[model samples]
Target: MVLVQNTNWNNAAKALKNISTATNFQLDKILNLSDKELEKLVMPSGYYHNKAKTVRNVLGMYQTSFSELKKLDTDTLREKLLAIKGVGEETADVMLLYLFNRPVFVADNYTRKFFSKYFKQKFTYASLRKNIMKNFAFTVKDAQEFHALLDVYGKQNK
Candidate 1:
């Protein structure tokens, strides 16, 4: 999945992983949780109430489930994801890539910095991610590794 090394990502992901593990990765069970409960579980994420609400709002859009969501064509799923109130491009792409095994590249700050600096070309989020995907065109694993390496190397340099 998304292996971004930002503190917020690390904390939030660990909290979510714990919750998913305890609930057997059942999105339904997660949705069934009370707002207060979900907030408490996600406290480590910061803005727990907001994040919990966002998670509920996004997940509520799904009528079926995870496997069913996976069955949807990537375009349809991406549209549905982007329609959510607070979900942006990177967020949507992260879910698609990590959760659904879609080969979409995630353009994060580290990615932008690394690419623009190394390539000596300023790039927009979509353009940079597209360039990375185009150049690495082959497999999802390669894209994941590239993103992870950018984060890892970015952290070290910082």
Candidate 2:
């Protein structure tokens, strides 16, 4: 959740480090933190308060249904993640692709922009993801690399 809507990789990494250090990488400890405490730790990541709440909510969901969620098919898992308060289509697809090693493409802004600029085509999240997955048989690693390459290229070009 920390990476969702966050662009500064350095700040995200620092926030992760702070949280992990404070909690000793323990889920129970992280879950026990007060909102203010969690917000303080994640302050560098921006939108600290909302992000903290999202982090807690996502972790709570994981704590409760992690094994079941992991076993779900890609579409099912994406739907479940989308049901969460802070998880939009991009965040849901990100969790599906990265956390579960699902092959669904994350139709994030970078992907959408890159395609739209080059192809003169507009795509909604579902349409872009569907079209890409339909056209390419991307393995987990391929999807990861493709997403990373798009991000890097987008950053550089911008």
Candidate 3:
């Protein structure tokens, strides 16, 4: 049984339609592209192709390997997600942290720039993710919210 069945099919269909409208291609064609190739095809703002490829790969991985993702433990699922193409640590962490209610911090360019500017810290992406996770006593929601808040703060302060 699919734990989280495609309950949002209508929303997914609508989003697919929007992508189709914007890109002039059917959903199937979009899905056919690999992550890196798809990333090259789409407009930067759309990021749709990359996202679609990731979703397709992830769903296929879950269906084929685990039967249902909700049945897997958080760490197991994170590992599974990281194995897929285009599924980096941040993306996997975001999926675990938000979708699966796991405690994990996601760091992106905004977080890195904001923190570096204010804290005068120099760290690579991996180290930055680790540093943020170590320093913040925040839930997944808090991390998301804080990231948004930092983006706003940076924009205004700039």
Which should have the higher TM-score, number 1 or number 2?
2
lDDT of 2 by residue, 27-57 (tens): 9999999999999988888988888888888
- Candidate 2 global lDDT: 0.85
Best by lDDT: 2
Cα lDDT, model 2, residue 64: 99
Off by over 4 Å in 3: 1-17, 20-52, 62-68, 71-73, 154-158
The Cα error of candidate 1 at residue 13, in Å, is 4.7
Query: Which regions in candidate 2 have their CA more than 4 angstroms from the true location?
Result: none
TM-score of each: 0.76, 0.91, 0.59
In angstroms, the error of model 2 at 48 is: 1.4
RMSD of each: 3.3, 1.6, 8.1
How many residue pairs clash in all the candidates, one count each? 0, 0, 0
Compose the digit string of candidate 3's lDDT tens values, residues 24-102. Answer: 6554555666666554543333445655566667656655665577578867887777888868876677677666766
User: Model 1 — which ten-residue stretch has the worst lDDT?
Assistant: 1-10
Candidate with maximal TM-score: 2
Candidate 1 local lDDT, 1-158, one digit each (tens): 22222344678777677677657668789889898888787677676766777778777765456667788997798877878776778878878877777877788887788888888988898887777766656467776777788878777776
lDDT of 1: 0.73
